[model samples]
Target: MFKLDEAKLQAVLKQLHQAIYNHERWHNDLIRTIICQQPHDHHDMAKDAHRRCRFGQWYYNDVPTEVRDHQAFLAIRTEHKHMHQLATQLLATAATKAAIAPHDYDAFANALDRLRLEIQTLSREIEESLYNHDPLTGALNRIGMLTSLRALHELVKRQVQQCCIAIMDLDHFKVINDSYGHAVGDKVLSASVRYLMDHLRPYDKVFRYGGEEFLISLPSTDLKAGHTMIERIREELGKPPLAFHGSKPIPLTVSFGLAMLDPEVNVEETIRRADKALYAAKSAGRNCSRKWDAVNSTPLA
Candidate 1:
């Protein structure tokens, strides 16, 4: 008469057991409610009497019984009560298990995992953006230059690329601040950065190394190519004097030191050598680009 197969029959039985346990717990709650309302009454005995009378009316009326038959009927009644108690406990446990099933719990776990991954990804992106950007000039900062330098060094080691590191410093930058005020001096610095960026190749990177000093990293370039680039920037900056606050334009000039990285040298030492060449350029006359000549002891004139 049942639609279910053997396995489904077992599952249905389990579900019925749970439903029976829930019914028993509900009945118990009713008894507790009555007892609590009338604290002095022995209400459990009265409840059992009521239930037995109801059961007799519903299923045991008009039956004539022998002595053995009556005894068997009493045994069946006892078994029914025991089964009700077992069903009550099973129903409670089943409800709790359903509440925490894999379907419910796994969704929550997956959401948390996604949130954590997004947070980490955003944090890494922010760090990388800040690493290469200069706060003042909006050019690459010193740390950014170093990162590019190291990459270039590796490329050269593999014989895959040639690169030059050129250092540029504004001539008499401190004098501009002293004579024209720091605001004017800042404008000059900004203009100088723009001038350098305007003339350089799109692949080139410029860094704000220090106060009034900048570094240029040129990939796929040799010493001669680097010198040509620096000369162009110097000429551009000298062409028109930068003006501030609608006043007369002030003359702006920069000194440069160009050096190609030796394949055997480390990135830091290569930058240092370029810096020494810059010092030599400044000592020479201030508005010139000088290539590092180790054999020539005399500084540029």
Candidate 2:
């Protein structure tokens, strides 16, 4: 049941697409009706119609139509279209310049083609994962986590992977903001994340969990190794104070909670266990790491 046949997948995707199309058509038709019945408010009707577009909505019930995922998706397509337009113009210029002067303009044409290829490659990457990074900390955001966890679950089902998730929270982050201002707090979060990335193995992935928390996913790592890794990261992170704007250094520490994947248990359940362990770490003390379901669980220094 985990892997759907191509026909089944096609059917499901087709149904989803059809539903979106139907909703869009309905919205447009309603707008058309309003255009005839209430000509004075056609502008408002048009705006509402776009706002209700299914493809642009995060959730069905969610209003305030500025969906980040939708915007990101559109931005990717728009940029690609713009690049294509540029390439077309470049090719046309190359033709004109060839007639007008020497063939040096051919280099411009070649570069334009290469740029087109790169843009296509970027589009493919974006399709594979929505929004590659968090703008602030340069970590993978929730979108990356969602896409990666799905693929990781597939590998785990094949018994070919042992991935653990570690959730870490900045201890007393609000106090940092209250003591030094939000700008300094922001710098601390970014610096702390940089420390985590620098300390962890290159293959390990870090995603911004929320405002001052992060989720580090360690592939081919079990619970015990994950615990050790998080402790090491915590130790390294505590060694340095975040230097903000080159003025002064602000001390920072993070608490971590970890959970290993159980093939029998769902990923959400595993994450919830890690979340509980995080709560335990926070309750015990600030700067520490803990693993869920550990016997005589003690906080790591």
TM-score per candidate, chains pooled: 0.55, 0.56
Question: Per-residue lDDT for 146-264 in model 1, tens only?
Answer: 77888888899999989988889999989889988988898888778867876787678888889999988899998777788788778778577765646778788899887777678
Which portions of model 2 show Cα errors greater than 4 Å?
1-130, 244-247, 294-301
Q: Model 2: per-residue lDDT, tens digit, 3-113?
A: 223344344345435544654464355335433442322322232333344533422343223222344333433433333344334334443443322343354345435
> Candidate 1: minimum summed lDDT over ten consecutive residues — where?
62-71
> What is the Cα-based lDDT of residue 223 in candidate 2?
85
Best TM-score goes to which candidate?
Answer: 2
User: Which residue pairs in model 1 clash with each other?
Assistant: 21-87, 21-88
Candidate 2 yields a Cα-based lDDT of 0.63
